[model samples]
Target: MIHSVLESVMTANGIHSINRLHRLFFKLFAWGIMGFVCAQTAYAVPVDTKSYDPASGVVVKIAGKTLVMGWDTPEGSTELTLNLSGKGALVRSITVAPGNGKPVEVLRDIDPVTILTVGQRDLKKRGGWTIFFDRTSRKPSESGPLTLKLKSAIVRSVGRRCIVELDGLEGQSFSGKLRFTLYAG
Candidate 1:
């Protein structure tokens, strides 16, 4: 009877140990699967997007202000023009919005300048555009809220399209949108 009791006790302990090991293995597997799923979901990229053509209509907003912005190249022209002449449309009006959602006119007929220029690879030509705010009118009525209205002549370059990037206007970085349209003339 004593031997039988001892045998039974040993069998029960063996069964318990096996069960504990199985449970530990299951927990580890579950954790690994959960971690993999979380990683995949976090790093997944979004799909399905619309194409933006700068030629149609481009509106750039910076610090809660809208500005007209785009580029134009002469027809059958291989070179980029820096001088803000009849070559392209310049930024005209600048509107500033106050904290209370009220817009105040700050600037009109704003003069734009080209700060940087780069040459084309094949033609070895350089071209770009930049607009500068008046030094006297740099101060805003409030802390934030500014907008810009940009106008440019239609781009007429055939081989390469002009690229217009707006920056260093109000703050450290350039924030805005661009719309471009191609015309026969």
Candidate 2:
């Protein structure tokens, strides 16, 4: 019966010692399991997600920041390479309109441009590093309306998906929704 009500509340507090009331009930059950594992790890582990595959990749939101690139993308000399393996400068952004309506500027920095490298300098502010998509997109257009800047630079192919909400830089705000694959060489 709860050990006779913990031996009548340890003999009215004088503590008659049943191993000091079982070490004060195992130190209040180890401080209630360390306060429930520090309140389940003190927040910041809620992720909220959804996915359907499509080669699985795309989540770039800058200004606050959040990038999880990987849509298995790769195409050059025409452009369409957003591999971010370079860690992408963290959104310095010469220009990026993930909304995909258009404005996908930053048509340079494909890693110091090799193949005998002939005259290449301007990397458009070097934002986030290596993010191709500019040869004027060769063709394929008709999903215009999320909004992009840099004279309406367009990049969409294979199966499009771009969602944007970027404002400011290095303060911490994010709204990203992006899927990948665009090749127009």
Candidate 3:
């Protein structure tokens, strides 16, 4: 029935080839549908669905705030938090690299390099998962994961947050990016 109707429209328009008319109809139909959908969604907010990388599972936050590595931020300053969401997902490694390729340094006798701390956060659970970095190894200048002394068993599930405390000398600022990889435990 539709083919006959198309043939009649083609005949009326002096178009003889049914194939050409069919193709033209489909093309115009597709364009009309696309235009309608675009017009409907033009005012909608764009969403990023593929932001989660394979290695990072679901990166809740990436460098939330700019942090100066070698500067002594006041006490209670916002600690860097890496929010992860996955079942049985544990941090396999965290590698740090300088943003400018220069080594992250905290010069002694010039700047105050304060204490650095990393902790496993499960608000529902108690506080048995905190690790303080050794003062000697606190000056990270290259790309490498921390040799965590604690066992890797902290699982980040729903409603949990992992926090790391970073502070260093105040003289020269050390800026860097940290990459964290996770694995199913």
Best model number under lDDT: 1
- Residues 71-121 of candidate 1: C-alpha lDDT, one tens digit per residue: 222322111122222222344444444343544456555445423222222
List the global CA lDDT of all models: 0.37, 0.36, 0.34
lDDT of 2: 0.36
Runs off by more than 4 Å, candidate 1:
1-13, 46-185
lDDT tens string, model 2, 96-151?
A: 44433344557533322112112233346446264354332443433322311111
**Candidate 1 structure, TM-score to reference:** 0.22
TM for every model, in the order presented, reads 0.22, 0.27, 0.22
Residue range 74-170, candidate 3, lDDT tens digits = 2211212222221121232233334434333222112112333433433333443433332324444333233222111122222222222221112
| Pairs with backbone N, CA or C atoms under 3 Å apart (clashes), candidate 2 | 64-173, 88-128, 89-128, 93-127
- Candidate with maximal TM-score: 2
Indicate the residue-level lDDT of 102 in model 3.
37
- Quality of model 3 by C-alpha lDDT: 0.34
Question: Whose lDDT is higher: candidate 1's or candidate 2's?
Answer: 1
On a 0 to 100 scale, what is the lDDT of residue 141 in model 2?
35
Indicate the residue-level lDDT of 18 in model 1. 59
Off by over 4 Å in 2: 1-4, 8-17, 20-26, 31-37, 51-53, 56-185
